[model samples]
Target: MNHRCPAVLVHGWRSHPGIWNRLAPVLSDTAVPFWRFDHTAMQGAGTETIALALRDYIRAKREETGYTGPVDIVCHSMGTCIARYLLEVLDGDAREEQVRQLVGIGPPNNGSAMAELFNDPERGPEVIRRLVGVFVPEDYDPGDDTIVQEFRPRSRTIAALRRAGTRDDIAYRILLGANLTATPAFFPVFSGKTWEFAPDGGWRTTYAGDGIVPHSDSLLPGAQVDVFPTDPANLARNPELYCHTILPKNPELVARVRDYLTLSARPAARTPPRS
Candidate 1:
């Protein structure tokens, strides 16, 4: 498909442009021209900082590519948070119109409890509190801070963003990671005693969710939602679907993104014949 507008790929927290390395070729395969957004220090950068950087990138892309049409956006994790701020919070009439569709991979659209888990001074361990603070900025006044404030479940920024929802002129697609059977070994280390044994009686703990953001938190209120299996083995076997970390490499995801960009859909996957 010959896209009139360029597709922009935004990487989430503590990430670089290299995150798109696996996904870019698939987009190119469909003849979709794309751009990767580069930003600094997800660990330290606030939401406003990331938003302004994205704004600059959009402006630069428009000038450099000389494309007057709307740009399609693809984002992962916290990158979607930044994109939402740009779309819902920023006041740019022309820029707003220039966004055609937004495809988010593993976004915390409704805010993540993970933030509140750490930000809760009364309950959260002191060490974890400091570490979590790096990613989530604190809310001081009624309407300030940046990344941290915006991601807390009950924060003013998140509530406002939720109320705004997606723009009428823009289309949205949200991909979710549903299974959370696997978690990093370090999660236990950081979780302290936060993880408890299941009352249902098994060798397992509670469903920790995608190892990061919970599945429920990933859904945007008004967007079309697509759920992918989050079991690592299933993801590995499918190769076409993804968990949060490898979303860009998921073949199914790449195809959907291409379809979204081209304004067309690939035929539904056919079931293989039983031997």
Candidate 2:
């Protein structure tokens, strides 16, 4: 163990750390400090409530570690939103100073099409689907403030991070995956979107979608995007990574993530070329 600044991993909405069990092994191989949090309760909650819970955990973790240093945060999907909120919205000079980097995969920085649909005015009260909002707890009122962002410029959390102006302190990188690859089954995410299957089994990743999220919404701002090849088996079986196509394990992609993190953290070496 390096015993220095540790790294934390936060999973996205309607998910658990277990979802990344395979990915976690990859991080462990690199000896990076990996942490996971269960935020099933954050679904309907407002920012403040979520922030308070995260702040409490941060303080607790700091005390537990008994170390004074920065910590790296790695997140995926909606979890990216929570981690960003913690780093930026929660008050603390020490935190801003200590954070080494923020790396997110499929973070939906702009917001998910599903979220937009839920927040859509045309949907009205029917927008809040009973089955879909299970992860969101009952306490937090969805009718509160309407910033509608995780960590973008307009988001309260992102605004705070920018105001803190510790750009030199904490760095950010985003890894993007097409929703088609993230989806569990090769199906359209939005209603009324579907593919016309031919008499034969062969089919393409049509305009329909992976299942839950759209491709356009997956690309968030302020982050670099890395496209991963869809799981070959997925193409063969017509099953995507997830409804969002963000979860299917792609080993090649795992290697890429390892490379990106290691390179990002590594000190560049100078070479003396010979004639």
Candidate 3:
């Protein structure tokens, strides 16, 4: 019997299961089942509410499969936050659920600074305009976005995540992209740099990010982080594909995720070589 844990895939905000279309094949194996969780139906719902639904989905899957073994969770962007809330907050205290690994791609573990930027009175409008055609639609409104609000730097959801902390039993792996070329093709809005909130109450851009999530934002005390395309030439070759929105489909990133999910043990973090 194949005892390898099942893999659960979670898509980020404003994203659909299609994002995993490229990765699903690599992760597909006769022994390991790939379960994709679609949150599009709950687009306007809060993270907690969506997470509750996720809990129910997992429970139902377990009941249907009769597989009580640990499952590996692979999520992207905001979906990472939702998965963490379910694993570390809701299931943390009880320690009853079985989750072997939590792999997050371009996750906003420290809360999304972009969410904060969207609500900024001075910069919100321009930022929204820049991301309209690319990351969001022309009619996008952060105020009307409950999930976005919950992911802001100082939101209650972020606070709860901090208080709950990560579970020791689960291995955490984070994959982040670096915009080495600083090309607009990588991400036009921020020019390949990620938005970050400074301690002095100001916004700044940094290259140590995937044009959406800054390295600092995804860094957790115990989680291992790996930046993609250790060679700058690789990113220079196809800068557009390394952006936040398209990361899940990037071939190189998908391969790394495959290795992480299938490897017998957690590997050491791989940092990009300094230019």
Candidate 4:
């Protein structure tokens, strides 16, 4: 292990490393080397598949960096699920302990009702297929399964992963958006205004959440929760603010994450990527 451990950044579903465009500079300023973990961007790849791939990536990074100790993880959206599985489910006690801190930005830790909208068997799947086209390029094949299919509230995969719960050894910070219409009316309505059946089969009260995930769902039982700032105009109508897609673009949010790493993590030597 090097004198310091590096931080790993994992992007959310249907997203690529480019999403870190804004946060990268902030992390660099902290003097801690960071790496981005990219997946196939196919939500249907399955959570276990993604978690295993992350495990492999972490192992490779460890070997290449010669840092056997735990590293920090910063994940956005569904990426939080994958990181949790890697740390709490797949990794051994010794290896899991190496994870120093985890910061989840707009993470759907519980589950998002939005997924159920498109994952519905009758008409939802088709809407999902069409929606996938809008986000990914034509060449990208999401196959039969989709991330939307997995993210539906009360999905089997999410249930399985939730069994392990968040690790107490790792420090966690969950950042959620509080507004639904901060941008413009034309923007898709992803705010927490929607509600879904809870695990107990009761209807959850609807409130403002990040455009994609409700603030309540974004929360973890033990992790610290920080609501992102809302647009100045929407403050009155929308006390809670921030959209799912814009999590990385917020300067204040990025600075907060950077500050966490700066204070919580020490600088580590750079490691070259494997050829």
Candidate 5:
């Protein structure tokens, strides 16, 4: 009998397992059983706390299934940072378990500029107001959101992640959305561009993002990165569906994720010798 590695699904902050409703079946069809990590109950918990819980959850699943091998992690947004804390910080130092691949969709790998924007003294309120009902809620306070605070560009948690760096043994794949047309329908909040903090402490917008996380925040050294809708025509068709909030259910992204998760399972093709 062949051994199939399990896939762990981690959703971002303020998100639920239902986000995986579309992607799960595709993975299931590939014979990969997915274990969804639901963090909704742990609202207001810090990333470290959630990461520890994640560790415990993975251990319990391993014990239950008696499979002690490597597992692939598929995460989105803040969940990517949480999973990184587990696999690169705690588990990386302890050398306990193994993770074959860390596939992140619209990940805030370098800490989130949106988080920083939300905490800004001058522009914070207006920013929050714009995102309300679309990305956040009415009267949402960044100060009250623990996970948001932790993912800020200057947060201690992000500093720790920078110190730990990525694990050499695990493969990292990043998928980010792009609004090539800069259409308002893509993401009405910021006029279809992602907000980013400049080196000079000023704010700027860029189309190389998913209306939430910019490409600059998602790029990690040694990680394979790909931008979605390689064809601009797709975004031109249904611009709103490619935003950061809806990436998990995006048909293009789901298919790409399925391909990444099942890559190892497929037998490698024979290489022809040079003539």
Candidate 6:
């Protein structure tokens, strides 16, 4: 814990911080004040509620880490959307500059299977509720998925960041997998409705997907696409590593993310952020 304005890692949907277990130590080894936080706020808490809660959490983290100014946010999967909300929507560009960098891994920046689920009448109800139980209740609506609403190229989030934007001042990096497939975890999309789940056949998302996110949606149309593997995934066997949520397990992916967060970043000493 030596980096003053150390990096804070955020994990994605239906997942815990354990996903970064192997990776955090690597960040720690960087001599940065690295930590992972619980994502209780992102679940089904809706947009504004989750945003304010996360805004408070980030403020607390920055203060606790003794960060004098901006802090890097390294996010995974759906966590990227949360990070975007924190910087772009919650605090706006004025405060976003305090963010040194945003490293998004396996981010469905365009949207997610959850977006597909949230939009699907059959699956959206069960997945959108903040509470997870065996049986899904009758009525639920997550309003509008910020990912679908706020993350697009011309999106309020992106547009706002772009307006208050700075290339050198605030960095953005996106990393996504290509060995994509359909997520079977979602309830089948066919409940006899005009809205079909696998519009592209049994796939729960777009044609070129990472099992959880469409490859195309992984990055905003014009945003930096960063890097992709040399090979496309085998749709049949569908390697487990290609799954939307499996990024932390791969040494290569971890290294890529590690490098992304650490590149050109000078090291600083550890201290609780100033409140």
Best model per lDDT: 5
RMSD after Cα superposition, model 6: 9.3
Q: Estimate the lDDT of model 4.
A: 0.66
Overall local distance difference test of candidate 2? 0.51
Clashing pairs in 4: 1-67, 43-147, 70-98, 178-240, 178-241, 179-240, 179-241, 190-211
For each candidate, the alpha-carbon lDDT, in order, equals: 0.64, 0.51, 0.85, 0.66, 0.86, 0.56
How far does residue 61 in candidate 3 sit from its true spot (Å)? 1.0
lDDT of 4 by residue, 1-275 (tens): 23445888999887888878888887776577788999955456878788888888888988897777778899988899888877877763556548888989988787766566544456444445544544434544333546756766677767866787777788888776554334433124422343444559654434345545666567777677665553445544434324567676667578777877766523321211111
| lDDT comparison, 1 vs 5, better candidate | 5
Clashing pairs in 5: none
Q: Residue 67 of model 1: what lDDT?
A: 79
- TM-score-sorted candidate list, best first: 3, 5, 4, 1, 6, 2
Weakest 10 consecutive residues of candidate 4 by summed lDDT: 266-275
Q: How many clashing pairs in candidate 1?
A: 3
- In candidate 1, the residue pairs with backbone N, CA or C atoms under 3 Å apart (3 or more residues apart, or in different chains) clash, namely 47-147, 136-148, 137-148
Q: Show pairs that collide, candidate 3.
A: none
TM-score, one value per model: 0.73, 0.63, 0.94, 0.77, 0.94, 0.65
Better of 4 and 6 by lDDT: 4
- What is the TM-score (0 to 1) of candidate 2? 0.63
The better candidate by lDDT, 5 or 6, is 5
